[model samples]
Target chain A: MKYATMRIISGAGERTLATITEVRSIAALFLHALHGCFRPSRALSASFFAQISRQILYTGVEAMGLVGIIAFFCGVTIVLQSMTTMPQFGVTEYFGNILVVAVVREMGPFFTSLVVIGRSGAALAAHIGTMRVNKEIDALEVMGIDPVHFVVVPALAGMTLSMICLNCYFDMIAIVGGLVIANVTVQVPFGIFLGKVLDALSWIDIVLSSSKGLVFGAVIAVVSCWYGMAVNNIRAVPQAAIRAVVGSMTVTIILNIVATVGFYAR
Target chain B: MPVKLEIDGIFWSAGVFPLLRGISLTVERGEIMVIGGRSGCGKSILLEICAGLKRPERGRIVWDDIDIATMSRNELLTARQRIGYVFQQYALIANYSIFENIALPLRSRGDLAEKEIDVRVHTVMEEVALFNVEKHFPESLSNGQLRAAALARALVTDPEMLFLDEPVSGLDPQTASGIRAVLHARQRRRERTIVTICHDLYLWASRPHRVAVLEGGKLVEPEENHAFRQMVEARR
Candidate 1:
């Protein structure tokens, strides 16, 4: 019994130590990426900017069609649910307020982030993991190139910029979808629905939603890249990609909840 | 400036299996040292440790009397800039074209303009006898072409020290001889130190200043015992 108790304690200690090491490593990686951003390295030549542009092209521009389709369907569903049920309770006049709060303040940033986490986050992790297995990262180190500066910084900057822009794009598409669905389903005029949405929307709501996108982007990039860098062999690439997706989604949801509570709890 | 490498009392292990046990060796400036051993006998691991690519569990690796273990990350990178390395597997970036792969070191240094980089990369490619494949990526290249590209990248910087792992493996006899000639000419033109790991002994018989055998996790000089003669005869 005593020996078993000792083994249990030892296992717990090892797990705690591993967790601490993981957190410290992630924090160090984040700081290095930030430093590369502010002061910049000599490697930040035209090629560096080209890398950032390429990342933006992959994570932002290429993902537009998917984000647009998802946003439109979500908008239509939300508006249909609200318009059909809200009038029976005599709260139809507050339709504008409900739509703005639900779509702009909450759903816009959240759903867009989920899409990015699924697509870009998994891809980033898999790419880096494959590089590590092939010893390409070591090759870069041998050439006196900082992988964090050359790889992670561009990814971080591009993902953040993409998230902010995609959030805005998602908001516009969803509202348009809502307007069309409202007019077609309930015979409500498009102008009145749009006017209500515009009236209920505030600059604060836009700022807060954009802020959530920014944070979510940084979190996804850091976590995915961290998992990618941790891979040591070929077998770990798919595992790292899966872990990156799950980790990014979990963190994004928790942060979304925190942002909502922090902003409105007062 | 030429640098002398000194490795002392190195101990390394993988998962409780000791691969190198208190191994030590040194190579002077401008010397060619070839380490030979059977496959999976930790020859590559020792070369990697000497090149500062992997840290040993206990030892000091010094370049020109400066201990590499004490150097900061940037300082270590600065030191590594004076060194060139070629991996056994090529390890070329999949996304980069051949020209970009060869020019990466120069681009990272950021001292020379694009014109100088282009000139230097072309020169090295020519020296390696690789032509007209500059725009192609690694995936499209043959094994010989890939090896040539990797060697060209290593030599583009004109480094003072070169650490090559099986640089001539998997090539025909003529291609292998050509690679050896290129390395010999480069070393003769400039006082460059080279440490190579190869299992093929006859390939490097006439070139290296010294040949050492790694067996039983210890490095032994060629003249130390009968095992050296046995290794050479085995290769023959």
Candidate 2:
């Protein structure tokens, strides 16, 4: 019995090692393809212009109104709730810092990733998955064009740039809307609220927020493309899209936690 | 134009099923070789091996004295540029305009100027009679148009050898015949070395200078059109 158990354990260990090696190799291939896609010298000016046009249409223009409404209401609600509670401790002055940290560093990246994942990530996965099912990827291979370079790179570049821009937009709207709410609803002077915002804001905070957004964008792009490529049939497209969004959101939140700890610890 | 493809004892498997077992074949320049078999007979696998997409477990694919199985990825890519592949599904990039789809391979070469690419693309599109539909997307195209667009893209680079995977399947009889006619015309015009996979024995009989029948993971004999058809019918 002891020898049999030992053999079984050894077999399982070998299987685990093989799985790990396969996963590592696939990860390395994905990273290499991503690197090729993002290399600046490979960017054709015409293709870049075309990608910018698509990004504006898909990410920026399509997402602006929804993000604007969400940010505005989020700011107002946070301020209203904070005012009701902070007066007990007379730490109402800390409201600006709380709002900035919560909204800018945490909520901003998280919400934007969620929105983009729902909108662009699903679309990207479905598009690419359909292309894969149709053998367009094989066609690219036959033509000697690396599908990663031609299809995936533009998407990563566009989404990363767009996510950063959206976060900035969200940040601007939320802070301004919070100031308005504090002035109108809480009877705080507009000048005092503005002064608090300016004082509480730091370059480090902006960098952290932008970094979070960048990571979220990368996660969404990579997960979407990975799932898209894995899809083999037409029926698998919707499931791949759903997986991309859910996977991106989950990774985004986890990464946010890690980033927050690292940023504050620094 | 003297392109030679020699596959020597190629062995392939999909997770130990052994799709192609020690398959060896050769196609000389200016010859049309039709790989005919029922579905799942590994004709596509053989074509993929020749295209360098599937590496044989233990064999060499030599193209004009160079073993493609041993080439570096970039070298394999360069070698692939000299071969045209028409996928069964007419794999035109959906998001791109037909012009852009044809232009994709040209852009990858990174050696051609934009002007040269445009000229080559236009010439090939004209050859395939797809010039008028260049602005349309693949999603908007009819089945015949899609196949033509795919063919135009395949032929754009003027590959020395062309591989067609079920080029006439899933089309109306009239449309399939028309595509076969176009393929025959193109072959005659260029005398290109072409390897096509098809189940339609009638179409295969009409065009191929040689026919290879794959059955049960083994390539059967005759390596000629008439004798191969006789063998196929006798088996049936």
Best by lDDT: 1
- TM-scores for every predicted model: 0.96, 0.88
Tens digit of lDDT per residue, candidate 1, span A24-126? Answer: 8877998999898786676546667888888889889998999999889878988988988898998887777877888888998998988899999999999
What lDDT tens digits, residue by residue, belong to model 1 across residues B170-213? Answer: 99888888888999898888979999988776678788988888
Number of the top-ranking candidate, with TM-score as the measure: 1
Model 1 RMSD in Å is: 1.7
Q: DockQ: which candidate is best?
A: 1
Q: What is candidate 2's lDDT per residue for A1-266, written digit by digit as tens? A: 99999999999999999767744643664586568655732424466558656965797678999888888887887888888998898877788888888788888888888889999999888888988888888787778767776667777778888899999899888888898999898688888998888788899889988998887887787778877887888999999999888877777888888998888798
User: Positional deviation of A82 in candidate 2, in angstroms?
Assistant: 1.5
- List the candidate 2 regions with Cα displacement exceeding 4 Å: A1-30, A37-45, B170-178, B222-236
Error of 1 at A33 (Å): 0.3
TM-score of chain B of each: 0.96, 0.88
Candidate 1 ranges beyond 4 A from true positions = A1-13, B223-228, B234-236
